[model samples]
Target: MSKLIIPLAIGAALLGAPAIPLPSGAGGGALQARELPAYLQCVPYAREVSGVRIFGDAHTWWSQASSRYERGNRPRVGAVMAFRPHRKMKLGHVAAVSKVIDSRTVLLDHANWSPINGRRGQIERDVKAIDVSPGNDWSEVRVWYAPLQALGKTRWPVHGFIYGDGAPAARPRVVSPPTHVAVTRAPSRQFASAFDAIRGGASPAGYRQAKPLPPQRGYRQAKPLVPQQQESQRKSQGQRTGAQARDPIAQVLARYD
Candidate 1:
């Protein structure tokens, strides 16, 4: 009766558990996991092509470049155009400027932007991007969509352009040496005694110059502590002792002794 109750509880728990959707090609129980196709994201692709080293989400690149890279609203070749997060684009997007057509239009090279052949993460090069802002400040833009074969209707907001030209290299961190290192009690006592001797105009006769340490070298065969003759004699004595212990006649003699 108790065993039946345990089985029933397990069955109820499993039935209530939610079903999780696995990615395509991730086969059933016994099959080994397969590698998914490479998906190139905008951030890494822009950094690789434009030479911008800024990290984190695409939207954050504008603020992060304030100290490291130069930024402006006007687009130029090799500059990354940062987009502000709008309705569906919660993380925003970035693209490298491939060519500057004029003040209002430019060519872009980016990835994972538009769905091509019904698949996302497709790379698009030299696609059109136009400044549609009322003041022509490049604050809003319309980018090319592969499916539509024209500029997308949505006016994606722009944070501006992050220029990689002459971007300052990250300064190496400078860790200042510790000002107050603790002195052990034994060393302090020794120093105090030496100071007292010097103050009293008395020479410290007990003090001697420390010997220099041995020079460091790569591994070498170590010299035996005892002389060769002594080591050989010790080995001979050990062998005789081991032989006697193993002999039954010697064992009986040893017990009597």
Candidate 2:
């Protein structure tokens, strides 16, 4: 009977028949493999943990938060650290700040950064990330690697941080009032001198010259000579000069006359 049963079981296994019950441990590995957690990406994990609500690729998070969320270079807890595409990381990376150890060090919770069990898209919790930028502005960083069990040697570029709050409102611009000046026009006066008037241009029709100032105290007023009086005085002076030339006694004779 035992020999008959053994032959029957062998025939069942060869023909691919399931007539016999298998052990409880049989195919356990395949079942566990099928039940493994699905691979996760950095973007969704960052959004979920940080509550930044950003979408699309990791590099675009900084720009997308410009108007919607507050962003800066300083790292804060619950903020998403946006990584710029560098080296072989073509699509870039994003991670949530679990803790800020100091000015230059931080702990990050992200996915797909380091592979586990010979597969990618694994989640890493509270991994160390150090700021390597010269200015200490968090512009560059080096993240912990699972394979090396240490911080990676590569200096990855970063795009700053995106906070979980809405952006502040813009301030209104102030304008100054226009200035006013007081201009006084000088009173119009007649030309002070004829030469000045001529240089300025020919006087307009009906233009009159300025009046002279009245004589002041202690000043003598002289009478102007007429044209005829001036000619008579010149003739008399010339006759006296001719008489002197004709006679040597003309000086005495002029005094007697």
Candidate 3:
């Protein structure tokens, strides 16, 4: 068999032993490739053992069209693929199935993978692949087996593969709320209130009121004389002068008048 399949055979043998429970957070929704056990609470351990850079959460692994896992989705050869988020764990998780040694065993590559409080980056650990049922239900599954040397320097209870507890029927898909839409509505109200405050001190349209001009200087009124009245005054003055001319003394008196 291929080198990849050998580890799987070893993992299958351990399946008969007592099962080890996965960390509480795994198993809720569809798994994605990048979302393997790394990048979550398990990241610190995965980096130490795998000697690879792991960043971002599992959501990065999703390919919108195909529900099935693909290498194009993750790019890395041995990278684990995670499923979509679920109600139980907001982030979904999965592992990269590296090698299939036999019907009962497969080589699993996963980071930050271990029992509760276990070390990370346990590379290419041997896991048993039991075909308990033909369908894709999570419950009809077998446990994975990890060797002591593969676990690096860290030592804990040496247990065999632990079968996963089957998930509930009718698994629910997790949907994140639309945050961008909510923010758009809030800015409209806040803008209107700001405009109203600015208008209060000036015009309702938010323009400064022009100051009233200083009171006009007092107006001087002159007597109004008709054109005919002005002409009559000139004739009367000429007649008086003519009568004064007839009498020398009267003329002098009239001139004085």
- What CA root-mean-square deviation does each model show from the true structure? 28.4, 38.8, 38.7
Worst 10 residues of 1 by lDDT: 248-257
How many clashes in each candidate? 0, 0, 15
Winning candidate number (lDDT): 1
Residues 142-207 of candidate 1: C-alpha lDDT, one tens digit per residue: 888888887787889999888899542222233567999796655577678888887897755587
Model 2, 132-153: lDDT tens per residue? 7767788988788999888787
Q: All models: lDDT?
A: 0.77, 0.75, 0.39
lDDT of 3 by residue, 33-77 (tens): 111232234333333333334444544433321233222321122
State model 3's lDDT.
0.39
Pairs of colliding residues, candidate 1: none
- The lDDT ranking, best first, is 1, 2, 3
- Which regions of candidate 1 deviate over 4 angstroms? 1-38, 167-257
What range of 10 consecutive residues in model 3 has the weakest lDDT sum?
Answer: 154-163
* Candidate 2 vs 3: which has more TM-score: 2
